[model samples]
Target: MTTGLLIVQILNGLQFGILLFLVAAGLTLVFGVMDFINLAHGVQYMLGAYLAVTFVGLTGSFVLGLVLALAAALVFGLALEFLVFRHLYERDHLDQVLATFGLILLLNQGVKMIWGAAPLSVPLPAFLTGNVALMDGILYPTYRFALIGSGLAVGALLWFIVEKTRTGMLLRAGASNAPMVSALGVDIRKLFMIVFAFGTMLAGFAGAMAAPILSVEPGMGDTVLILAFVVIVIGGIGSIRGAFVAALIVGLVDTLGRSFMNDLLRLFMSAPSARATGAALSSMLIYLLMAVVLFVRPEGLLPARGRT
Candidate 1:
């Protein structure tokens, strides 16, 4: 690949990694601290995009739409926690999976009914519509740079909150031993609510930011949900640092593999065979990476401190 193309691909990979981190960060916290399974977290992301479309359309302002979408997502997530998830917390994981999966089906259909089956797009704000030159001949989308920058900023903020704040200390303690944290006089349930709400907002913000780049449509969050799961597993279930690092790795491997596998294969095989082999191998690259990581470090690359 040419230098410019390679640079662009790297940026694309970084952008994708940032998006994955946003979803996975919240997911890891809920899974790690609350020990709860939320298969419908992806639905929160989808809802964010859908909400952004609705609000932005009404107001013609991207920033306002994003804020409103985040608020709505937080409220809706709390509602789900109250109406559905709280009951499942003490139940078996099988029940959590079944309940959340059903919610996914319900919400997917709900979106179709409300927004129609067709895909929707969000118009970028004027400041975000153009491209910036990385070099004399290379350019990248301004919005993507903003996405990467914002994700990094969020990552830093998340690190601060999780590493420095009282809530974070409680979250870490809960992840290590929930019953102990509860016995220590912390309202564990309230903490759960806060964690779940924060996670919902993060996932929603990722969706709202991504709406301009990806098609806003029904069931769009399913693939992202899967990727987020992979991210948590690789990063260690409860570790924010692990999630950030693993997300960037997974994003780079997946993006770079898809972009250049065929060309790389052509150096050793015939064109048609290379194309077939490249496509197959590229699709498996992330999973293979996951398998390798699990094999080497069962707890993952950077498991949380108390995970053992």
Candidate 2:
């Protein structure tokens, strides 16, 4: 690959890493703090895109759609928390999996029923359309650049919240040992709700930001959901810091692997064979990375609690 192509791929990786970080941030918190396995979390992302499309269509304004969609996502998430997830706090992980898996089915069908089966995309705001030149001949989309900026800004904000704030300290405590924190009488249930809702918004925001770039459709979140899981596994659940680092790692690995795999393989074999093998292997790269991490550190890279 040319130097320019390499630069573009790096930028692409960074942008994608930011999005993964956003999604995984919530997933890790939900898993870590509440000790709940929420397989349905990805649906929140799908709903965010669908809601944005509907609201934007109705209001004829992207900003309005975003605001309304965020509100709707929070409301729906809270409803789910109250109606279903709340009851499972005391249940086993298997039950949480079964219930949340059912939720995935419900949500996928729900989106199809409301939005149809066809893929969709929200129009980018006029100002976001177009590209910018960086190095010699490389050009990147402005909207994607915006996404990177926004994601990093949010990452910084989240870091501050999780690392420096009082609520963050409580969350860390809860992640490490929820029973102990509850024993202190902090209304652990309320803390759970706050974490749940905030995480939902983060995942939803990722969906909304991605809608303009990625295909928006029923079950779209399913793939991203798996990726989010990979992120948390690699990062170490309950640690926002871990999620951030692992996300960037996965993003860079996935993006760069896909971009360069064919070329790398071509160096050793036939072009056609290299193309086919590289494509399949590239797709598995992140999972392989996750598995390797698990092998080395079963609890994850930066586990939430005391060292095992």
Q: Give the winner by lDDT.
A: 1
Model 1 segments beyond 4 Å from truth? none
The list of candidate 2 runs beyond 4 A from truth reads none
- Overall local distance difference test of candidate 2: 0.90
Clashes per prediction? 0, 0
Whole-model lDDT values for every prediction: 0.95, 0.90
**Which residue pairs show backbone clashes in model 1?**
none
Q: lDDT per residue, candidate 1, 1-308, as tens digits?
A: 79999999999999999999999999999999988899999999999999999988998998988888889888999999999999999989999999999999999999999999999999997779899999997989999999999999999999999889999899999999999999989999999999999999999999999999999999999999999999999999999999999999999999999999999999999999999999999999999999999999999999998877
| Top candidate by TM-score | 1
lDDT of 2 at 71: 94
Error of 1 at 168 (Å): 0.8
lDDT of 2 at 116: 95
Please write out the lDDT profile of model 2 over residues 88-150, one tens digit for every residue.
989999999999999999999989998899998888878889999896677899999999999
Q: Which ten residues in a row have the lowest lDDT in candidate 2?
A: 299-308
